[model samples]
Target: MEQANQNQDYQAGDIVYVFYRNPHTQDVANIQAAAVVNHPEKENELALFLYETYYPLSDEVAIYSTEEEANQAYHYYYGEATEGVLE
Candidate 1:
């Protein structure tokens, strides 16, 4: 039960979902599947693999174990979409 607010540690190779914003279309976002992998530049830490990039796995990032949870959070946060780009 990995909820967005849980900040649970995920094992490497695990699959998770996140509400990702389109880099090009900042205001639009959608649920995307990501992978938990060993951090390339850190020891004993995990990283998220999404959009061909490795993002550090930390509380700053929200991750969900299921699509339903991700979608739920998406609606809660972005509500039907507007405009906001990714960093």
Candidate 2:
């Protein structure tokens, strides 16, 4: 999903939520990440990611280093494709 702030289009430093369907189940995932920068190869796609949140668990939380990684994570968590927007 895409959202504009102050009537301006989305850009780096803007927080965004990416929603995607679970690959196994028909669920949805809402992952938050920051836009890294403009991707020349992919005009519509931007580099985004989420860091592992602080938690006391055996494994660290998921952190997608790239937009594709995050997108794959969403798809894996949810069952279908997802669309997102500013929350």
TM-score of 1: 0.78
Between which residue pairs do clashes occur in model 1? Answer: 26-84, 27-83, 27-84
Q: What lDDT would each prediction earn against the true structure?
A: 0.76, 0.44
What is the number of backbone collisions in each predicted candidate, taken in the order shown? 3, 8
> Residue 25 deviation, candidate 1, in Å?
1.2
Tens-digit lDDT string for candidate 1 (7-76): 5758999998876777898866777889999998899888999988999787767788877677767767
Top lDDT prediction, candidate number: 1
RMSD of each: 4.9, 13.1
Model 1, position 59, has a per-residue lDDT of: 76
Question: Distance from true position, residue 64, model 1, in Å?
Answer: 0.8
